[model samples]
Target: MLTVKRLDIADARILIKGASEKANEIGVPMCIAITDESGNLIAFERMDGGKVSSAFVAQDKAFTAAAARKATHEYNAANVPGNLAFGIHTEVGGKLSTVGGGLPVVVDGDVVGGIGLSSGTPQQDMDCAQAGIDYFLQNRG
Candidate 1:
């Protein structure tokens, strides 16, 4: 038998709340996505004025983070031309992202989920995603 840990709906809400707060603070409405360890969607939010096209992008980012167990930015770094890892974003039906807005949610050194944000510059999105993970860590009791 195998045991697995994953995020639930309440956890997803916490991630969204934290990410949205950061987005509001940064004056960038965003689309936030939370996914289970297996990259299954748990919850999603599109803040007011968030770009409609970003909805799916945020989800894909989260999927890449959770399923790959690494931040999307890390992939971006390794996905440059002539690198063996290049073109990885073309995998998983083009769902894998090399963008900077995706982060794996880790608890006790275990990746339990992921958070992703879009509708802003990549740096802003990355900040919001980190904020979500910070909030989850501080409030997951």
Candidate 2:
């Protein structure tokens, strides 16, 4: 049987810090969340000026990414047009956001968690997420 490694609180904190730094650099507050492979929340943070509502949105995005084992944006884009699964997000308790800022957190090339960021423009959100991922990869080993 194949075994998988999961992200821990430390990992989540690292990602969150990276995301927060990026958001601060861009002068945008952000809400960031991390979830396990089963879509359970691991850790989360909301910047001082972040939208209060974005906290839930970040959790939803992380849950959707981890549960689907794919970046939410990719799922959204791939399932558009003739794909019935495109609506799956709606059925998943409406906890999914097909936006660009949610990404699966992979370890050993396998998705073990997810990271989600909100409270910025879509592109800025994505950039913050990317910064977090980059930090994880750089410091993980």
Candidate 3:
């Protein structure tokens, strides 16, 4: 038998809160998404003024992070033409993302979930996603 850790709704909300704060700090309204270890969404938020197109993108980012257990940017870095992973973005019914905003949420060396943000530049989105993880680590009690 195998045991797995997953994120609850409360954990999902914390991720969204931290990511949103960073987005606000950076002056970008964002779409934030949180997913359990299997890439199932737990919570999502679209701030006022956030781009509508970013909604699904954020979810896809979160799914990639959680299911792949890696930051989406790492995939982006290795997705160059002629690379074996080049077509990964088209996998999983086009749900996998090679963008910079998705990060796995690790707890005690185990990935418990994922966080993803969109509506800003890829770098900005990555920053907010990282901020969300930092905040969750500090406040996971």
Candidate 4:
């Protein structure tokens, strides 16, 4: 049987800090969320100027990536055009947003969690998420 590991709150904190630092450097307020592999919320933060609406969206994005075990954009891209997984966003309790800023957090080639960022342009959001992922990978205990 295959086993899946879960992310602890300490790791979640690390991800949030990394993402926040990147957002601060870019002068963009952000909402960052982390979720365990099973799509449960692990941690979240919303900077002072981040849109309140982004909180839920960020959480959903993180959950979707973690549950799907793929970057949301990849899922969207591969599912288009006659693919049954197409419009999966509508089936996953409407929790999946196939946007460009959410990424799955992998460990040992297995997804263990996910990170999501919002409140900037798509590129900026992706950059902030990448920073978080890098931090997690480098600092893993």
TM-score against native, each model: 0.98, 0.91, 0.98, 0.90
TM-score of 1: 0.98
Against the hidden true structure, what lDDT does model 3 obtain? 0.94
Q: Candidate 4: how many backbone clashes?
A: 0
State residue 88's C-alpha deviation in candidate 2, in Å: 2.5
Q: Which tens-of-lDDT digit does each residue in 1-141 have in candidate 2? A: 977678999999988988899999999999999998888999999999999988988898888888888787787786686786667667577887787788888887888899999999878888998899889888875
lDDT against the true structure, per candidate, is 0.95, 0.86, 0.94, 0.87
Q: Which residue pairs does candidate 4 place in steric collision? A: none
On the 0 to 100 scale, the lDDT of residue 123 in model 2 is: 81
Model 3: per-residue Cα lDDT over 22-135, one tens digit each = 998999999999999999999999999999999999999999999999999999998999998888889999999999999999999999999989999999999999999999
Answer with 2 or 3, whichever has the higher TM-score.
3
Clashes of each: 0, 0, 0, 0
Pairs that collide, model 1: none
RMSD of 4: 1.7
**Model 2, 77: alpha-carbon shift in Å?**
1.1
Order of candidates by lDDT, top first? 1, 3, 4, 2
The window of 10 residues in a row where model 3 has the poorest summed lDDT is 132-141
Judging by lDDT, tell me the better candidate of 1 and 2: 1
